[model samples]
Target chain A: MSEVIIPNVTRDDRIGSVFNHLFRIIAESEKLEGKVLWNFQDVHFFHPFFVFPFSLYRYELSNKKNVECKGMNDVVQSYFSTIKFFDFMDLREIGDFNNVLKCYKEKSYTPICRFSLSDKNIERMQSIIKDVILQQIKLPINIESHLSYMLGEFVCNMEEHSQGKYGYIFSQYLKKEKSLYLCLADDGISIYSSYIFKEKHLDKIDEYESSALRLAKAGYSSKDRPEAENRGYGISTNSNLLVKGFGGAFFILSGGAFHREEAENNIFIELPKSIRWNGTIILMKIPLSEAKNVNLYKYMER
Target chain B: MKRNTIKLSTLLGENITSRSSLQILCNILKSNDVIDMSDIVFISRSVADELCYFEESYNIMFVGMSDFTRKMLSLVRKNRNKPRKRQEQDSKFVVCDDIETLLSVVSSI
Candidate 1:
């Protein structure tokens, strides 16, 4: 397999950089004497910041070729169209999980298992993961529920917020450390846009920094009906699930800012600097022992 | 129990009945056997789109399809393949013709 390394560069036109790499790989594959299986594997740290434009490029490329592209199954394909794009964004988190798994495997760690979301294969993927976890780890029922619930929350947010631009989800298990790392990402309207949409007069405000701060606060939403019951619960619920329940570290990066939940009080503290990205990315770490404590109101103040 | 039936005419109207009928069809497919497409005399593209979503979700196999249904499917496929073009024709008759054949084919499936 050929590998292409993208050098660390300034964040100007990140989308263009990704597309340039993708197109070059496609072009080079076409020139090969036989059918060349191309994998755009080396590009790393590509947050949801570039997923939208990259997906659009992929869609247009597929149309230009006029042949059905098979790699992106239903969940992935939904990210390209307006109908289901927002709903499918969290699926991108799988990409981040896959990357971490690759890193751990290289260090001689054995991963429990992995799966992908395809239109035809979603059932199979879920079964495989469930079977592996049940037989190997013997995870408790409550722990399993916790994991599933968290996963659902992440995936649901992607669908609701990303507007079908781009999203992925991934998980990795490290045997030696007995820990799991999961990441979800989306290239869509950032917290900045969410805030701006709710407060139109704030349009002139520098969104990148302020959006990050607001996201760290509880009971805050970019939605118009914030006062309505259950309006702004996802982030706060997620934070509670991570800190009090799982005793896990939660990191959220959006609108060029990053925030981490403190382990003791579960307070969301802003990171020193913004992340230099246009969208949202979340990384979560869970230890096996603490996974059992995941609960609904662990992090909620009331 | 006999399958709950909704007439094609009632399904076509722009009212709550249309939405309810479509939703009923979707719910039935979730638990029951394959739908008898042959009995379906007429269906709008909107209905077809909903059916496609159900078919995809359940992984339902289209076993029997009438020629009209096939033609409608083909037309839908063809239309999606290229840009939409305005063709002078009677929309009502076209739907009626396709519905009969497609329903027959679907029932067989």
Candidate 2:
């Protein structure tokens, strides 16, 4: 059995780097056809960042190799269980229609849930935004509007672009940090893969992920090149609002590229050679204080 | 001019973020109808973009947005009508190929 040791993604480790490291393990082990054992011995604190990526990739890994996750301590397992991480192992969904089960408002973390762009899921997510998210933050209407719009744009983009049947999301309000941590991921055609078809984007393409991320940030859409649908506004506007408007952090890792953004800094870089996310993973930290003062127009109206 | 008023908040509480859905709803209204955004606590950018198209309504007037909502909408309206440059500027990023340079550069902004 091939054993892949899961690293502790604690406060000490740079989250983006840790995530990529974990992803590197999965990407490298995909060719191994035998039983794959995931060791969680090093994990002590269970951060939500690990749940989305591992859950998404673990399922895919299971298809090619018999996957077994062990070494989870009580705390790690409990956190994972609460978020329904194990449930996804068998591809089992808690809600048949569209519900990422909720424990209570007090739990402060919404279980990872699957969604689509269907009208029903849109409504469901709206409810989640208000009840699950807004209620927790208890911000005034201004922040409420931007937060709802930001979250909706990300999810809707996934619905419209991911081309995957179900997009997954998990959000938690970290009271200590006064920030909302949200991660949206999908196992679908990645941004880099989709952009290869665009003739305008081709000449600008680099062997690295710089071109794909730049194109995405620059409002280039693989689907709507010059159409009227405002296809590319989601990533650009939302990133601007988070990093520029709210002083928050926005991150996206897809294929071989990872882009990280904040108010004063923006970095787009290629992941280690041969390390690529088959689909995409987006991790955002919405600073609660700055979000309250966020001016949606500043980012959106451009 | 026949006037019909529709409250966006009634459809989806104080926040209305969906653009295509809002456009579809606006499609059903007459050019003279009044759509109330007053009850709306927040209006998303894309939805506001669609709303800007109603400048003449060819069809309707978006009304009733709170001062904050109105301010947000007005910005979208202002930019939507402004003539945009034919050549879209390329997005700039300080891409770091190596760890030292990446560490030296700001990672995200």
Best by TM-score: 2
lDDT tens digits, residues B12-49, model 2?
A: 56666666566556556676778878667666666666
Q: List candidate 2 stretches off by more than 4 Å.
A: A12-15, A88-102, A138-142, A193-209, A221-231, A289-293, B10-14, B23-31, B54-58, B81-109
lDDT of 1 by residue, A1-302 (tens): 33223322223131122323433444443344433332333333333323433333334344444322334345434333321222222222444534433433333212322222222222223323323343344445445434544554454454445443545554445455565655566656666566665573264445245433444344344442322322244565665667657766666656544455545322222222311344666666666776554454333221
How would you class the docking of model 1? incorrect
- Interface RMSD, Å, model 1: 28.1
Per-residue lDDT, model 1, residue B108, is: 27
- Model 1, residue A12: distance off in Å is 26
TM-score of each: 0.43, 0.80
- Per model, kept true contacts as a fraction are 0.00, 0.16
How would the docking of model 2 be graded? acceptable
- For the predicted complex of model 1, DockQ is 0.01
Error of 2 at B9 (Å): 3.7
Count of clashes, each model: 30, 14
Index of the highest-DockQ prediction: 2
